[model samples]
Target chain A: MVTNEDAARLITAIKTSSTYDFTDYSDKSFCRRIEKILLDNNMDLNQLIHKIGKDKDFLEQMVKDITVNTTELFRNPEMWQTLRYHILPKFKKNRSIFIWHAGCSSGQEIYSMLILLNELGMFDQAKVFATDINTDMLEAAKAGQYKYRFNLGYLDNFDKVIKENPFNFEDKVDVPYEKYFDIDKVKDTIQMKPFLREKAVFRKHDLVKDGNVFYSKFDLIFCRNVIIYFNNKLQSRVIDMFNSSLNRDGYLILGSHESILGASANNFERSKGFYKKKQM
Target chain B: MNDYKAIMIGGSAGSFQVVSRIIAALPANYPLPILMCLHRLKHIRSGFVEALSIKSKLPIIEPHDKEPLKAGRIYLAPANYHMYIELGNRFSLSTEDVVNHSRPSIDLSFFSASYNFKKKLVGIILSGANKDGALGLKSVTDNGGLTIVQDPKECQVPTMTTASMNATKVDYVFSTKQIIDFLLKLA
Candidate 1:
């Protein structure tokens, strides 16, 4: 296991050797991830830091390993229901709906959004942008393929959010799963349809250091499940950035379990499963 | 004894009634914050805190990610997430893959709390069907903190307490009544 001092040393080594800075990450989570990495690579903190300082390939791999990338299609069903019934309709009148998926790991969320937009007939009017710090995740997002068995549970989320209208029990839509993606149970793969895969613009962008890389005010920014890894200072900085990046009354949707803390939370009015930028 | 900054309790299976009774016994003015990591059904997000709150004088909460830890309150690990007590006395939640077949793994929570508070912390393990909290209780000892286990002879399920005893030499093997007595002494 890595000690707190060893974690600090590793963070500093990574910062000095690369442009990445983890100074503002939650210390406990960072240390735990490092401990896992150390165990997996069969190296102590000193050896890991030594390789980080010397080998670029090894350093890149280490950085990627440090990032938590477990994501599934429509992970939170209720949040998607809120987006579908309540949030999306509010933006329907707008000619172009700008949606940004910041820290969009593995792109399940972006596809999730696209499927929703297409269902609502708002796809043509939507401009979607996705970004992540991990280039590997970006590539995986582009491929838009996931394990069928592993994500089988989340497929229920798709049905809950898409096919069934919660407001009316009799209002059931017969939308087949193949309409959005192809599933091969024998191969254990779920591949996003080619059109859905190509809809979003994917980029490699770091949330900590980068500032509004898209340079457009978004109507809805989904930074779900991403800010939990950040410390209060970094969370505030990112929240402030999201506050600025959003249009007036724009939505900032986070993971169900995540909420804004500190003074930065003042920028948004809390709604069910999401936050709306408060009008100045 | 009064110098202890926090108390961490890990339990599962038949531990709820034990925890409820302990919390019911604690006064509202209890000084140290109680951190609990109990194995729970991941999909059921609500009602756990409300149920736990029914018997306690202190406020029971499933802490949001990065929420600051406060004294005189019971912080239950939220469903489907790992809760950590960070160095800054704030709570950080993680959706990282499950450990020991549990998302809110007892070992992970105890590890962080023990590291943060060191000798100023007290770790307790209660009735559990699994051995998740064994290494975590050992971590408390490793970091010079006090460790306790509900006496296995008195536990509904003895695996966790037994495993913890085999993992490290705990400071106390208290019954439910004795555990309450130990906490009240701290207050």
Candidate 2:
């Protein structure tokens, strides 16, 4: 059993020696991830800490694994509805738009935004910067490929949640199974369309180290469903970064269950799923 | 009225039918709050709340962050998030790693209520494939709260109910109809 003191020491050592910071994340969740990492690497707690103390690659892999990048497209339909109805109207006055999708795992959400923008007829005018620490996921996102099983379900959900007309049968949509995928009958490989491939740029960026990317102010930022892994302090710091990154009156969207209320409540106003930067 | 403050229901696998039946049986004026944690796939769209709401006599909604826990209403767990009650009539949501491979794990909510409500909590464990609610029911019983389990013979999936039976002497081992009657008697 790794004591809290041991975890705290490891966190302190990593912050001073390396760029990653795990000190402020939820203790229970962070400890659980660490336990899993130790089990996967077949290391006892002491050995794992010692290995992390010396090995840079091992440390990087551990940070990436423990980051908790799991998210689904439009995980909460109501939040997206809130964004469409309440938040998007504010952006109508802007001539151009910038969006930063941090921790954009597998790019389903980036594509979801692209589709939303397309529906809003703003896709051509928007520039989206999508980044994640996982290079493999970024590559997959860039390739615009996903398993067929996920696509079937996503298509069903997209039609219901986004299209909002369950009566319009999915078969009526010209989503030529081919348009969305390149299917291999024998090998069972399916490649998805690189949705908004031209308008979006994919990059590998760590939120902990590359904290300065927010220098270019954006009109909207969607960092949904990613912060549950961070400790309270890191959550506060990242919310600060998000606050700073937005231009005046810009919107920040978060996971439905997440709230900046307790930690960063004063910085933004709650509107549906968004926290709008208080006018300076 | 007895201090029947809040009720927590736990189920897995064949829970949808049981949940629907319970909600349908409740009167519109049912005065206590009800919270449910049902195990389902993380990715699939859930119509559990909607389906139940249509059949239910009381108001039903998903719990929002810091949303006050009000009486005369039912709140179902949103898919893929853990829902727990806070100290003072509020809800807390967390994407904390899964326990027993379930995010809206029954154990988390039951344990939280057991600690917070003591005898004021009423726990019911229904149909499930695994023993997710055994420890949770135990927690409720040990904490002086009331515990109920679906009769194994009546359950579509008996593993979870059987586990609860083997682990502790649950207050009630009733069928879905009998469970509704039991709740009505308490109400």
Candidate 3:
């Protein structure tokens, strides 16, 4: 059992040795992650304290483990379909649309949005801001490459999205996923096309920290599946940031599972599971 | 048993119908809060709570993080997130990598609730294909909580029950009918 003092010392050591401050994260989950790190290394708290400064990769790896959860391409396809059909089409006529993919871990959501934009013929009009706190994830996102093989469910979702593509049924605008990716047999990865890579700027930013949002106003913000670890107070702070970051009537898309009921969010309107910032 | 504040039940494939039936058996005002962690598909949003609620006497909820766990309610692990109880009866969620090949692993919830609720919980293992709930049941027993397993013969998939039995000494083994009776008696 890890004592509060042990957790405190660990937090202090981590903050002193690194740029990440997880003080605002939920205490139990944070402490559990510390325990996991210790268990993974077969080291006691004192050894972990010693390792904080000596091992250059240790703290980085620990933060990465705690923060980077599984993300998928075209995750929760119906939500994407809603965005494609109802929300994003309005942005087609706007001049220079700015979109932020907050906590865009491994860049799947970023690429997914880009794919939609290209299909909608709005790719060139969009300037994408993709950010994550994990340096390693941001580096991977910068490369714009992913595994050639995707989850079968992902393919299933793609198929459903196309079959359910009610907006362009007559036009038959297709999602040519293969066109954006080519197989690298030796590397076992798919290289995202160079053209799509040019549209987005990647950065490392913490969601909990103020002034870390890339732009003051966004036409749309996609911050999905990133806030579950946060306690209610932190969640409210992040939502407030999202509410402020969005432009008038701009969309804030959360994960399918996230419920927005707890937050005041009085300035946001629900439009097909996506929240729109009201012009208050 | 009146002092027991919470009940935790876990399972994977083929557990849903059983879970619903058990919920149907319990009263609307069942005194103990029920915490359940069942393996579910990650890609799609589930209507699991609503589906289970159709037959349940009590309200079924997909609890959010830091929410207080209330008695006479059923709290389910949301799709793709592991569920844990913070030390003070507030729920916490984690997106940590799936354990035992399942997010919302039975073991994760059982361990946490056992650590906190201690002898005040009744941890149960039901129908599942994987061995996810076995170690969790062990944790409950270690914490002096009562343990129950659905008998393998009655399970749609017996692997989970057999695994639980192999992991620790389960207090009672009941078929679906017997389990329903047990819940009714508790009510």
Distance from true location, Cα of A143 in model 1, Å = 1.4
Once superposed on the true structure, which residue ranges of model 3 sit more than 4 Å away at CA? A1-5, A53-57, A166-174, A184-187, A213-215, A260-263, B41-47
Q: What is the TM-score of each candidate's chain B when compared with the real chain B?
A: 0.98, 0.95, 0.96
Candidate 3 residue lDDT tens string, A113-212: 8877887789888988988888889888878777656544555665656445756666554566677766676776777898877779988888877554
Residues A1-280, candidate 1, lDDT per residue (tens digit)? 7777888898999999999999988888888899999899999888988988999999888889888886778877878888999999999999999999998999999999999999999999999999999999999999999999977876788888889988887999989999999999999999999999888998888989998988689999999878899988899999999999999879999987799888998889998968999998
The numbered model that scores best in lDDT is 1
Pull out the clashing pairs in model 3.
Answer: none
User: TM-score of chain B, candidate 3?
Assistant: 0.96
Residues A30-100, candidate 2, lDDT per residue (tens digit)? 55567778778898877877787898988878777776656555556666666666677667667888899
Candidate 1's DockQ is: 0.76
The best-first sequence of candidates by TM-score reads 1, 3, 2
Candidate 2 residue A267 Cα shift, in angstroms, is 4.6
Docking class of 2: incorrect
> What DockQ do the predictions score, one after another?
0.76, 0.23, 0.56
How would you class the docking of model 3?
Answer: medium
RMSD, every candidate, angstroms: 1.8, 5.0, 2.6
Model 3 RMSD in Å is 2.6
